[model samples]
Target: MPEDAPERVEGHTTRRVLVTGAASGLGAALTAAFRARGDEVLATDVVSTPLDHRDGPVEHREHDVLRLDVTSDDDWAAALATVEERWGGLDILVNNAGVAGGGRIDVAGLDEWEWITGINLFGVVRGCRTFVPMLKRQRSGQIVNVASLAGLVHPAGMASYNAVKAGVVALTETLGHELAPYDVGASVVCPSYFRTNLMDSLRGADEALGGVVTALVETSPFTADEIAAAVLAGLDAGEEVILPDPAARAAWELKQTDRAAYVDQMRRQAARLDQLA
Candidate 1:
């Protein structure tokens, strides 16, 4: 242990955690967050790049990086086997693997739609489906699926992204209800926007409108580490909808109070996209 590192909580049990998309973004940030709190983390990304964990809890682990594809059954099985063999049990799974894709829904082709849905939506679906049994058998575990505010607020140009994340939100909500009886926790994250690499994977997006989205993201008052901390706090408190920022929280309230009003407001905001040209 580092001399200056914060001490682990007294009597705190170390949790065995698996995080997808662990190479970067929320995954990498949250992996460090879990490790900082003395939790054992299995960080997986489809890309096999070695993680730069030179000085963290996972720095001295037997393996710091595990290659697992969120969209592949073989990969999920292999990852579970590795976890089973190493830890003999699992405690936390953060299904954070996803891609960003958007444009006008009318012009967004089937190929891009499939590509985004495959990675963003189906990827989360596979993670939940594959890990639910383990969690059920243990009768206690946490599943955190990362959705987006786009799911709750349907803006223009993000039709597919909205659909996928909304599906995640709904699926995880239902899963939470099902897991309540077993004492397992389920949560869906609906963060508005933070600084992350999600923008790097955008597909079929209009350049002018993309600039608007990028501006909003970059100018947002939140950071990825902040989001990660929010995730940890939310999970620790057993919160179902983990809205990481004030913007997301307020929007959530609006949607809950009046769906038609929220939709009208979103339609008004999305009208700007048409003027972007």
Candidate 2:
């Protein structure tokens, strides 16, 4: 995208959307989704890796991909400052930056817990803390935080991932209450097995367990783009909790209707994983 591209589309009310973790996977897909709708997006991540922008809707827009480490307070301040100065104000904030440390609590040390939580939970806290004031001043905005179905239904060997994502779920649910009076809507997306590289970055995780996760996800019917589609639609409709995959929706319902059964089922799944290991 050109730096001097038009701020607004000729006849459309272009929205100013800032998406974190936009270097790949769901974040990149969501950025493209918004860009396809002609919105100005600030796509950010921790690195400047070359992106897959071919045939993307961002071909003729002002959506620049930037390097932003979400765990850094200074990075949050600088990123928002750039948005405030260049785009004038923020309309949509997607805190999609997160990490998954794929191991049980016993295998994952306190260090792993702290690492994933820094980006998964506290990063979201900082994003909302930094931008809510701006949104309140503007009197309208939306926030989308990416959690996981693991938050709804815990599985084995994912204690840290489950822990941080559950916190994100709680945080975003509370954010909805706090932002309503200011007319700022909040959403927490609980995505199930999608074809993202989430398992690839796992720290101190079993290689066999990672393979199992990848196989399950790759065999699923959903993709990153499909999840992004659900997220964009839910955001447009002001839906609170966005469950993008059928497995996620099922798990959410099971948690609501039969907590004991859900736990038993997960226990069996854990037993199977034990056998595999």
Candidate 3:
């Protein structure tokens, strides 16, 4: 363990978790998981309303979502205030609000780059900046940043998306060290494609590449709830980097153990993407 690793608490202690992008997908799954474990969750999203999924309305529960645009500092501040007023201080901060975009480096426009970065990367930054001080003051908290497999094992035709997710990975790692002395822990969740409405936020100059990603997401055997369960288990085990799926674990292991084979596979994928484009 690292020198700054926080000591694990014993026994069941209810935590107050604030999850962004909790309107649906992995975020909603996380919210539900924590609540099921007898923790309090303040779910926030770009929309403040009753939670609804693609399948149907969320089952009637005492669910109230706050409106929080992660890109906005004012919104983040408001969230902090609300947390203080309601929960005294937050125990876990889940920076999971992100949009997806991918294309060839030359094909993706700067506008597309900015839009995705604002939500995917900087959104997490803003959340940390706003809440880290409070966490440090209290000397206890955890941060979970939701990244993607692209962050760890980058393929082709996703330059912007890869860069931002990789940034999240770097940020989370750095925080793990920086906040360790304060009795705080940080984890980065890098799950591969699963059945999620993440495609709803997909935007790219290359429509074909978008379609390819959509298919991968739609066809994945894993579900958001499954991924959420894995995340909680990883946290329980004091893991800093959580690879929630077997594919993610395998790809990361391949990259770590055999550089030559990983490079060859990435090259092959790039060539295939070129053919599709």
lDDT of 2: 0.82
Ranking by lDDT: 3, 1, 2
Off by over 4 Å in 3: 1-11, 52-54, 59-63
Candidate with best lDDT: 3
Angstrom error at residue 120, model 2: 1.1
- List the candidate 2 regions with Cα displacement exceeding 4 Å: 1-12, 53-63
Tens-place lDDT per residue, model 1, 1-277, is 7563435866778899999988778888888888878788888988766353221233424475689888899998888889889888789999998988777867678898899888888888888888888889999999999999987877777888899999999989899999988888889999998887777777674676577778887788888889999988998787888998888999889989999998898887788878886
Summing lDDT over every window of 10 consecutive residues in candidate 2, give the lowest-scoring window: 53-62
Candidate 3 residue lDDT tens string, 45-124:
89655463343466523334688999999999999998999888989999998898989988999999999999999999
Candidate 1 residues lying further than 4 Å off, grouped into runs, are 1-7, 50-62, 258-261
Ranking by TM-score: 3, 1, 2
Per-residue lDDT of 117 in model 1: 86
**What's the TM for model 2?**
0.90
Give the per-residue Cα lDDT of candidate 3 at 201: 87
The lDDT of each candidate is 0.83, 0.82, 0.89
RMSD after CA superposition, every candidate:
2.9, 3.1, 6.0
Query: In angstroms, how far off is 82's CA in candidate 3?
Result: 0.1
